[model samples]
Target: MDEMMPHSHLPAVGVADDEPSLAGVIAEDVAAWCRRLSSTLLEETGESLLGKLRAEADILRTLVDGEGSVVDGQPQAPPYRDRKGRLRNQTNPVTSARNPVAPPMALVGSDGESEFSVVLPIQYQGPPKTLHGGYVSVLLDETMWHAVRTALDGISFTRELTVTYERPVPLGVPLTVRGRVTSTDGRKTFAEGEVLAGGEVCARASGLWIAPRR
Candidate 1:
């Protein structure tokens, strides 16, 4: 299904900060709360807590919404790049410390192949104790593109992604995701990736990435 999604022309670049910022820490905390809420069953109304959260959300929205940096006295718009000039959106969602929705994915290694360790929570459950197939596809696509940006030349976009589900991805268990370039032909680069649970392949994908013309 990832193949049918409209491709964005935005440049894919760079790794996130090696160290976590205060904001990143806060985001992760919020994400943790969200995960708890997802799994918890409430016998009574949560309106009081919901009200407090709504007020907090308003405060946060004011701070983050439409906020941009003043680079050299020039106000930049949304989607600002980091100090290292890497685009913010290109940060690894799987391993991002700042994104609340991002799973607790830790980077194991990335030389030519990008590898990550992750465990999907109940929020990502599609069926009884299994990871959603769509999320699996998205993760594979992201990892494969990360491999392309890490190992190939120039910026690339997803042209096609084919994901095969071998087994149900069980939630709340350790999983490994890995991607690497398999071959390159002219403007296109072919990459393959997989998600493994309990040392066995659960989901695997192959994708075509195309570098735009300069």
Candidate 2:
């Protein structure tokens, strides 16, 4: 958990005005910082960086609550003391996706819905630079249901999922997934997702999600 390793190489932050410009600079800095953070965590923990990250999220919570600084030019408020209080809570589903954790995919722009993209590396490969089918399903399911959760507020789980692959999802290439809820019936939610490469759809998915039973 050496914070220095990931962020040390990042460009020094300078004062900037407005959100857009500041976001661009902060994005670049965070990317570099994440790289260092991942490498350092791997070296020290002998576990996936995502695992270390989850373990340290509480500490990050404290820092974010105490400091309340601008991240990527967007001002963020303090962290919630409990899961119910956080703006976006990923702990439950993230824990469900255990065995091998999914990395924190970036939140791209949303056209009235939620969109995200994740870059798979050699380590994430399943078949000669192709992403594993299971991981693909996980990504699609998580993003699709998360879109619903983002728009509304509730705990949900995938009840059923159907994914169609038009082409093999290549590794090392950025895979973009976008999703939105089509409709909801009480505890059940229906959603759809599209996986894209170079702006072309490679795979599409539809899912039925249900609220987790208490």
Candidate 3:
């Protein structure tokens, strides 16, 4: 609705091949198409296409069980080292390219303040054409965490978070996210974040974080 911020443009889904696994990007494309298919009317051709895709998925399921850990017979992702030899989480529900459910909110800037943006697709919808309230809170919490991480220069865990929903966030629109540190008290840090859509504040959140001792 309103003009997007400078440098806030998100890259096309599945185009993020810079991450460790090319398969992750490919999976993002597949997941996106699956979401599109969910919103489409199924005709004869569509049903036939689904059959083919199911067959291929069965093959993939067999091939992937070897990589990650198994718990209760389900494979779980494990942390892996990146090109720089830094260990990275296997998947992050908010920002990891490997997780299909992620709006994969992108961080654009963190110079004293943190800024992120995401375009929620059909899969993230709750009530007609609006994003799920839970996800709005997730974005706010994550943005606040980034604000604390950047400002405090260390890892911290959220102690408490409070969110207020001001308006319904629509699906398929770019939403601006912003967060900043409000103050610090010894090991405790405080921050707030807001999600804006169409130039209006759709939701706001404030959080307290506890930084681990160095």
- Report the lDDT tens digits of candidate 1 across residue range 64-161: 44233222232111233655676554234455543456674666435558887887777788888999899999888877777877776567788899
Model 2, position 74: C-alpha lDDT score: 34
Cα deviation of 161, candidate 3, in Å: 0.5
lDDT of each: 0.67, 0.58, 0.68
- Candidate 2: residue 16 lDDT (0-100): 31
lDDT of 2 by residue, 1-214 (tens): 1111111101122333233533343443343345545545634654566677776665455443433335435322111123333232112222121112434476643432678777766545577878878777867776786676775555666667889988888877787988888887887778899888888888899977777555
Per-model tally of clashing residue pairs: 0, 2, 0
Task: Assess the local accuracy of residue 163 in candidate 2 as a C-alpha lDDT between 0 and 100.
Answer: 92
- The superposed Cα distance between candidate 2 and the true structure at residue 122, in angstroms, equals 0.9
Model 3, 1-214: lDDT tens digits are 1221111012122233344343443454454445445544222257777786676566456435433323224112333555565655445667755455566677865654798988887667789899899999888877877887777765677788889999999888899989999999999889999999988999999878887677
C-alpha RMSD (angstroms) for model 2: 12.6
